[model samples]
Target chain A: MYMVAFLGPNASYTHQAARDRFNQDTCVLSPQVTIEDVFQQVQSRVAKFGVVPFENSTNGSVVFTLDLFADIKSRHPDIVVCGEAYVDVHHCLLGRGAARLTDTSLSSKTDSPTSSGQATPTSKVPYPKTPAVKPVVPVKHVKKLYSHPQAWGQCRDFLSTYLKGVERQDVSSTSRAAELVAEDQSGSSAAISSAIAAEVHGLDVLARNIEDSADNKTRFFILKRTDCLEHQPMHRGAKVVDDDQNSFKSLVSFTVNHEDPGSLADSLAVFKSYKLNLTSINTRPSGLVPWNYIFFIEFKGRRENDGATGAVNAALRDLNNVAKCWRWLGSWESEL
Target chain B: MYMVAFLGPNASYTHQAARDRFNQDTCVLSPQVTIEDVFQQVQSRVAKFGVVPFENSTNGSVVFTLDLFADIKSRHPDIVVCGEAYVDVHHCLLGRGAARLTDTSLSSKTDSPTSSGQATPTSKVPYPKTPAVKPVVPVKHVKKLYSHPQAWGQCRDFLSTYLKGVERQDVSSTSRAAELVAEDQSGSSAAISSAIAAEVHGLDVLARNIEDSADNKTRFFILKRTDCLEHQPMHRGAKVVDDDQNSFKSLVSFTVNHEDPGSLADSLAVFKSYKLNLTSINTRPSGLVPWNYIFFIEFKGRRENDGATGAVNAALRDLNNVAKCWRWLGSWESEL
Candidate 1:
């Protein structure tokens, strides 16, 4: 059985994405504290693949992971971006389960990510009988809500309406928030976390889908060490990245060659000539020099393909005229 | 008295920087739980100015602050980036002061930034009677160390050599780490925090300057409300940012016109044509379009200057050929 790891305390969004993307029965999904730890585990051969968050719909791209990719490309041969997965992030207010589930009819117009099979309760506290589509939070009783900072930002509307004036404490991770509430078990304290965290930590789900945006989702990248790509079995639940699939994506990191005007535009021109569609673009410090930067670009197409291979070479040649250094991070099939 | 706020729990690096950059006697300095809180306080006019971490020598830019700048630009007219300050970070192992500063001679080759006026120690525990230059930590006596994640990262070298295998826990801030140690008052518990924390919390500096890097430093940006910039007084420890200073920096955010070939290069060319020396460049999701990004470029010279104003107008005119949108965040003197 292959071992896979994700950023954790077990119930983090990364953990949920890992479980959803990889086979939990065949692969041992371990959790590491930070994103770098996930990368290190894959590098050290302790895990065959590591899953890390790449971006979020509401909060935007995860720059740390992107910066790490830029850093690793400079040192290691290059990590392989094996596959991609999208996890619909559904946040819940987790409590002690002491209060019986209430307001079963208060479900979102959009259902929770996982529980279509069962009708889930939207809130534990009773509310005024209004035929509103959205659930109303019981503002007075919720004295405090604990969660990651991102969670607080995502749930601002719910917080303003239901938990307004309530003290919110930011923990390191959502899972940590659940863990804290589980340990404390105070009446007024609850956590905004993944529904799985409530299960893992033996907490109660007071409300479901509490995020301000119904379309909250996170994208994750499955990465493997460059040296051990071949002879490796498919990561339990991950799909094979086929070159024929239009879903394939190639990630490239490069730096501008000159401080001249339009230099950055020149490097990006290669992608246009290749007829590539960029999915994301990011810039991070080179770390070698103060104020220097490495640009990361993700475009649709596999490097292994005939058309892509030629485009890759052509782009590299053209970019060399305007960029100091460039490296292909990897190509993977990311199914939307 | 002007009110100034910083990210803190009293002795956080932001708090230290705020105190050093603003007059303590007149300005009422306050501690905030999050960086956003500082920004919000200043934006809401609750505080005349706020100080926030901008970049770290080792960790690179504090992206949150940068992202916040991009965000606020679209909403507010643009908060003025008034002045910059550099604080040399010095980490210390703090205990209850009950341990009797065992190795009074313990100190790193680099001392605390403010302790240069005093004699330095070279060891925390009783060592061989030799004139050693480096300070040593009594790792054998320490069972656990609490600190912010950044603190733990900065002090890895000391932890590995002297405190190998010791349990480490992450808190919100370094000051919180000291607060935890003070609350527990346990003989085996220590905290990696600022020297000022030990003094405020009545803890002893068991070991000083435990950070791995010798030149550990953090830079802070002083922020002010948009409407109040005209009548604003020079912050106590900060120099007035004259519009005419050659050290001025202009922060601009823009996006490529299209995914067409060389689009990004074309947008950057304006900088070169304008002869703007970009001191730093960053990229963030434009937030308007998925995967589309806004590039943040910080360059030497102010937007108000004759040369710079012409350059800005020229760059904007030239960039319109390739960029979708652009906004000048602010300009202020950032002397070396």
Candidate 2:
């Protein structure tokens, strides 16, 4: 049986994405401690596939994933991205015996900022003069909140509105936060975690979909060894469909001659010449020096058959002349 | 006294950078709980200046800082970056009653990776068959390691080689981690924090400069209200010397016409046309909609006098035609 690894203690967002992308009946799901562990598992052939978060719509790029890719040419060179999965990251406020928000009015009210389509900056007032509408859950009873650091940012509106000035403690994962809340004997702590984590840890969902953005989504990269793709087809149960732009996507990382003026522009010109639609661009510390950078460019194109005929291939060949160094990270079916 | 807000509980890397950039006798160093708090402090005019981390040499950009800028044109329009400070981040392992690293051999030994100059990927083996040299500290006594999540990635080699299988707990900041270790009654926890944090929290430095890269530096942006800059001069005693490049650096953020075929490339072409050297480029979710991005471009040029004569002014004028919308974030004396 094929084994798939994900960043998890279980029920984390990555775990949910892994389950969504693989058929449990055919593939055994394994939980790795860190994103690096997931990469190591695939690199060492311990797992046939690995799932790691690429970015969040609310937060930007997961720097850990990008940093790993920045050095891929030197380390874990055999791994390649095979597919992607998107998970709606709806967070819940979980606590021991906290009221399960049965009132639909609260969810709709809290989602007002999202519906207005304003990128609402966090309110200046921590406790905004206690809204006239009474909270279903007694937030004043809670003395501490627990979650991964990223969750605090995502739930900014909800937090500042109800639970501002409360002591917040960061844990390894949101699931771990839920676990800590479950173990707390004081009943004064709450956690921002997934509903599944609440169920696993036997905590009540005080609130649901508390994320400031209603459409908070996380993108995950499904990875596998490049050598294994010939025998192993795409995962059996992934539901990623080709959108209207039915084209393949490829990601490449490269460093231009920093000392030379216009070196970066010269490299970017190749993509335009190839008529490739650039989807995203990001930069990371090259790890070779303090200020030098490695740039990752994702563009719409195909790398099938690994030959020189494709536009992506041609652009890459042309890129070699302008870039001091470059590496093709992967090519996968486009989901945009 | 002038107040400078920073992201800290105190003794954090941000605090160190703030202390280095501001004279405490003239400017009061205030510790804000979060990066957002620091921004809000400046936006609310509660503080004359704010210090927030921009990027780390080992890790990349701090997304929180970038995300705040993603919506600056709408949210915090008055804030502008006036200067930047670089802090050499050397993490120390702090534990209550833990032996100080009196032996200098370990420091010299770990320096091998930095000296070799190869972007050293993490070793495959988690516990590499115990080294012949005895470790200075008793690793078996430690049950938990505490640090900010980013610190873990920076100290990967050291952690994997010596502290494999130890439980790691994430905290709000490295200083908070040190505080936790100092308060731990079990004496089984150690924290990765700054040397100043170890001294402040009354913890012994089990290890010094434990970060994988010898030159792990963090760059911080010194922010101030745009309106206040005209009345007051740069902070009392920031010793930012003009570098040999002797050019001014400006940061601009914009959203290109996504529907246009070559809108982004055309927008970038303006810099080349103006002969402005692009220093760095980054992208963050625009927050207006899912997958829509705001591009931040930092280039070496002058944007003084707020008129249309300068090359940067002319390029920005050209960019206005190509981009759907744009904002000039700031201009400051170049440090590079």
Candidate 3:
């Protein structure tokens, strides 16, 4: 049986992604932590493979995931990204009851049970506890909004304009927010999370399509510990069929050592020379040193099958002296 | 009196940033919402200037602020960044009481009140009325861990390793977490927040330096609706006329239409031709369109000064058709 691991709390988006990419028959492990933990799990053979979010069309790159890749590549030379998954994110407002309870004892004496009774009259402001699972909050009693940082930021305009003067809180994951609101007896707080999270936690949907952008999608990766499937096809149709199947995409990350003029031009020349179509290119601080950057590049072909692979390999080999480090992250299609 | 606005709940890092950069006696307004609110406040003449975080060394660009600039330039043409400030961020774990509490409830049903009486002889759980903060039970018992998304993310390693199975809840702001934790009588909850927040809410410090990276610092912008002062040099022998006067580093943001491949190249060439040294460059998805991007660029020169002003004007004139929009953000030195 294939062992699959994902960043989780059972029903996290990453878990959904892993299930979507890997066969349902595969044994899946959900680690309640980060993508780094997913990598570690795979590295330690706790799982054969792991799924982690790498980027979002809306939020650019997931820096932590990239950092994890860098750390893993530096320490463990065997791990490689074997598959990719693209999941469209539609954030929903999730809460347990109809309406959120506002005026939750703003006074400092709330800790005292005696004082809590005094604040209940003011704190008991009932929000309409509509049981419908609509994604949109028609009436704006949303005083506090909970979401992942990226989700919160993507919906900044809507929250600022509609939920004006309301509180916007950031959580580790959207699923966590959904869990919080679902368990919250107080109806005043709502979480901006996934529809699945809302379904799992039985949260009331306040608002739908709250994101400023409609095409909000996140990309995830399934990385293997031993580069077991490195010889897979580069561009095998859009679908995959196997016992433990996953769609594939090319993932490459490299460091540009020099910041001089035309440094980017010379680097792009390698891709251009190989006729490779780059889907995305993002530069983020290396975290290892100040001002230095790590450029993550996503493209159309897998690292093993396409002719572009040999070209890229040759280019990296030639540039490796000046380039800090370069490697293939993963190529499998992500399940979502 | 120069009026300045910033994101706040009082004593927030943004508030300290504005105070450090602007006039010592400058009238300050702490808006409870987004940086866009600050821009609107300035444009509406409610405040003469605004301060907002624009970037961080560890986190890269503050894309939300950059998006706001794009909106401000298109909708309200009056406001611009007049100065910049850089501030260090230090996160702390806080709770209520003196010594940290290790375990608060013996059973999961601590809310039942009656469950508190049915204590098992082997369990070493502290009574609910311990009066001091303690390490919450693992994820199995933890109801919630409150904190800002960034704080939670920066401390992901610690949370994953130590708190492992706990439910991580997101709050609108770290300060809000402290407020909630102060009011929560439940012993299974705690908050990761700033020391200042802990002090305000009368909570205790549970942890220190929880961030994965030690060199975390955020850069803030001091913005205004109208130009308030002309840039001047601070010579070593210059006479000090007013002790309340301030100096700031100017930040300007503009976009080059990427509809054409040469557009960005043409626009960037103007900066090169004029010999302007750009300090930073970051790109974000334009809210107006799905794939379109807006680039936020920072330079060292002051737009208020003739040399810098002339260069910017020349660049704009040369790249008029390719230029989407441009604005001066603000300038201010951050307090150490």
Candidate 4:
């Protein structure tokens, strides 16, 4: 079986996307500690494909992924984005299944105000509710909350209303948080994680879809080494159905002379001439100097025929002449 | 005194930039918990000015700051980027001054490999060589290394070479990491933080400039309320010297119909027509849908007069006509 690496211990949003994008039967899912690790795994040929979070609908670009792409020309030249998968990020509040808990619905919305005049709940006592039904922990009963730091901001509305004054701790990932909460002997600890994470760690889902935004989603890129593209079996979930499907999108990174007027516009104009519809544009620090940026442009286009100078090839050829330096990240089958 | 809010407890990189950009005697420094807190303070008029990290040479853009700018139109419409400051990020390994420590220089470079074949150090005993020297904790004795998540990547070389196998803990900020190490009763804990953070938290610097990159720098934006720009006294460090100095750069955010080909190119053409040199371009998720982006363009230009259709004003007018929607983020004097 081919190894498919993803950012995970287990049950992260990236893991979800990876599972959704690749066939588990033919590809063994390997969990990596970091996004860089995933790239390193693919670069070393330890994994046939690697998945990393690219962007979030609410949080914006994942800088780690963008920075890695920025250094693609020098560091991981053989690596290319092959496909993409998106996972709707629905955060869940998780706790020990056996813990005594209070129903948040039974608690009053307006708790007693602290000296600071904010509604700070001072009580940690679990108000027993539906004891005959099942033992579940209340958010108010939890003395501490654990999750990835990003989760706190995403679940601000749910947190402030339910668990005011609770100590929020940052873990390596949301899955790790659930794992920690599961290992905790004290019932007072809980975590903001995914429902799948709760299941993997054998914890109970205290709340579902606790994120502030309804449409929170994270996009992940499926990456593979360019030289190993051939002799690779198509994963069942991959969208590469045909060569002429007109469903391909290309990503190109380039730098322009900052001192030249309209240099950026001139580079972008090449896309117009090629009739490639522009979908997205982004920039990242070049790391060589302050204020220097590497611009990445994504557009609807066809993959270049090998040595044939196709439409994308023609555009990139023109772009290379216009840009100070350029690198084609990849042309992948667009999911949507 | 004008209140200047920054992302800080005391000595984060943002706090250092805030201090460097504003006169200490004329401005009262107020530390905020998060970047959003700094923006909220400025928007509520609690602070006249706010400082937040925009991008880092190593880490790319700070998504927290970018996401805030994405919603500037509806959330903080009055906030504007008035100035910018750059901070040289020099990380230091800090520990309790009273702790017994060893000199890392005396330790052997080659450590024992773990069962996994990775070179993981098995010993935590402090090798005391500098008995006559200052009491500095050795990295080998550190059971835990605390810092912001970004610092780990920045100091990868240093960490792998000197402090391999040390457990890393992520805190809210580097300064907060220093504060945690200071408060830790266990002498085994150390922190990777700023030099200023060590001084403020009464921790001894175990190592200096531990970051992997020599050119690692963070850029911060100095923000102010647009309505309060008139009566605002000239900050001693601000670069708003003259209106026609050609040092001004404006940041504008806009969106175009994705179905419309060459729409982005047309919007960018307006800058070229007005003779505005484009310096940088970026995009953030519009938050409305997946794949939809809000493009931000920064260029050399002057702020528009109240009623005069200046070069920038005319260019923006044209851009607005071409774009589906647009918002002028700010015009600020460029530091570089």
lDDT (0-100) at residue B288 of candidate 3?
Answer: 56
Expressed as tens digits, the lDDT of each residue in B1-336 for candidate 4 is 779999988888888888777778888999998788888899889999999998888877787787788874366777888878778998888985433435443332333342112233423212312111211334455678898999998886567656667788998889889988988866668899999988898888887887867788888898888887543344554444776626788888898998898899989989999899988787877878766888888889866452457888888889978999988877877777
Off by over 4 Å in 4: A97-137, A230-246, A306-309, B97-137, B231-245, B304-307
Per-residue CA lDDT of model 1 for B53-143, tens digit only, reads 9887666777678778877334334466776778889888887443353443332234343222222233322231222123343334566
Clashes by residue pair, model 4: none
Error of 2 at B4 (Å): 2.7
Chain B TM-score list for all models:
0.81, 0.86, 0.75, 0.85
Best by TM-score: 4
lDDT (Cα, tens digit) per residue for candidate 2, span B144-210: 9999888998886667656766798887689989999988866778999999998899887766777
Question: TM-score for model 3?
Answer: 0.69
Better of 3 and 4 by TM-score: 4
Which digits, one per residue and each the tens of the lDDT, describe model 4 over residues A139-223?
Answer: 4456799999878878765676566678989998999999999888666688999999988988888778878677888888889
lDDT of 2 by residue, A97-159 (tens): 434334433223343332232223445643332222223455545679999988998887677
Q: Can you rank all candidates by TM-score, best first? A: 4, 2, 1, 3
Docking level for model 3: incorrect
* lDDT per residue as tens, model 1, A197-301: 989988777778877667778889988887765423344455555556356788888887545545665666677677776666776667565446678888877
Q: How displaced is residue B10 in candidate 4, in Å?
A: 1.9
Lowest summed lDDT over 10 consecutive residues: which window, candidate 3 chain B?
B123-132
TM-scores of the candidates are: 0.77, 0.84, 0.69, 0.86
Second chain of candidate 4: TM-score?
A: 0.85
Model 4: reference contacts kept, as a fraction = 0.79
User: What are the Cα lDDT values of the candidates?
Assistant: 0.70, 0.78, 0.59, 0.77
What is the alpha-carbon interface RMSD for each candidate? 5.0, 1.3, 5.3, 3.3
**lDDT of candidate 1 vs native?**
0.70
Query: Residue-wise lDDT of candidate 3 within B1-336, one digit each (tens)?
Result: 545678876657787676565554535455546666776777777777677887666666666677777773354567676555567777766664322344544233233322232223222122322212223322223357887666766665455444545677766677777788888765456788777777778876656666666677777766666545643112223434332212223455566554443444445555556555444556665655544556665543444444534765565566565567765555433232
